[model samples]
Target: MNTTTLASTTRLNPVSRPLPVLLAMEDDAEDVGRLSPDDRLTCHVHGRWIHQCVASPLHVNPITRHRWCRSCATALTVSVDELSGAVTMSCPRCGHGASAASARLIVACRASLVAARRGSGARAA
Candidate 1:
């Protein structure tokens, strides 16, 4: 997507910004991997409250593993840099940082997950 289109598709609605940097510092980079079942919930959390993307309602958050949106599946792949411990959500279809909003979303979602797991009480199952 072009910058304008991407901007419209993904706005700057970052609910959690600084937390991602903190997570990068605290967690090992190798700890992050392909999205797992828990990571599915992370996407859900981001879709509903953070990004408000329309495609989110159609997403399937199954218990068996992590899921990606059609767009995310097609254009992006999320990974963690082992040396820095930073969760890097990159778009293979595009170039590095091609999707800044997506990168921010990943960071925000991961941060929120860490907070929720650490007793932030943002949501509960």
Candidate 2:
């Protein structure tokens, strides 16, 4: 038989593989505290991660009324430098500095981003 035919036959008649019990259980387990600051956890006034959500496009501080990039009028994109553990948000259009709110959010999410990167490393599964 040709290589293609053999491959198709193997796919059609799939081999039965044993399911991993531990993995299945772990999948069912609730992921508490898995959400980072950037996640869609809703705030009463701001809605879901309003300060960080890309869909929002503009973040207005309720208290200060400060906008991320006044000149560009565009929302800042969050970037995490995993190597340096430095988090920064900058305007996608003009590369403007972050506003007061954006700066605070960057500082808050830096540790979380670093932790996430470290946890993403290959582990014995």
Candidate 3:
């Protein structure tokens, strides 16, 4: 696994609740004290929802081509439709920037968006 892809940028501390639980319990932008709003199901940084804020420049990765169009040298644009649960990342110049990392990010965004809208996030036992 590439550590860079999933690395989290957040303040650290010991927290008892697992990730799913925290994601479910905390509302949008709620810090939950220890964890950043940027959970695994949310984002890699920016401490924001996957669907809400993926346009950050930090999301671009040239090596992994996550949100970068190497040939065009452009950061791919993110499109997410909460109502339809659709998510996509593509380069505006050429419309071709699919990548493994971006695919994973898309899946995460779709799940997070669906769960947030439906209030179906996993609950702790």
**How many Å off is the CA of 49 in candidate 2?**
11
| lDDT, candidate 2, 1-125, per-residue tens | 12222112222454321123212222233133323322222222332222224234344443442336777765556665657766666767988845666655554445334333333332322
Poorly placed runs, candidate 3 (over 4 Å)? 1-39, 120-125
Better of 1 and 3 by TM-score: 3
What Cα-based lDDT does every candidate model obtain? 0.35, 0.40, 0.61
Candidates sorted on TM-score, descending? 3, 2, 1
Instruction: Report backbone clashes per prediction.
Output: 0, 0, 0
The global Cα lDDT (0 to 1) of model 3 is 0.61
Stretches of candidate 1 exceeding 4 Å from the true structure: 1-74, 80-85, 93-97, 120-125
lDDT against true structure, model 1: 0.35
Cα lDDT tens digits, model 3, 27-111, are 4334334333233455535545667777678777888787888889889999888778889899999999777778877766775
Query: Number of the top candidate by TM-score?
Result: 3
Evaluate residue 103 in candidate 3 and report its C-alpha lDDT on the 0 to 100 scale.
Answer: 80
> Compared with the true structure, what per-residue lDDT tens digits does model 1 show for residues 1-125?
12222112122332232334423322332144323222221333342322223134333332211222344444344554333435544445544434434544555555444443433332332
Deviation of model 3 at 30, angstroms = 19
Q: Which residue pairs does candidate 1 place in steric collision?
A: none
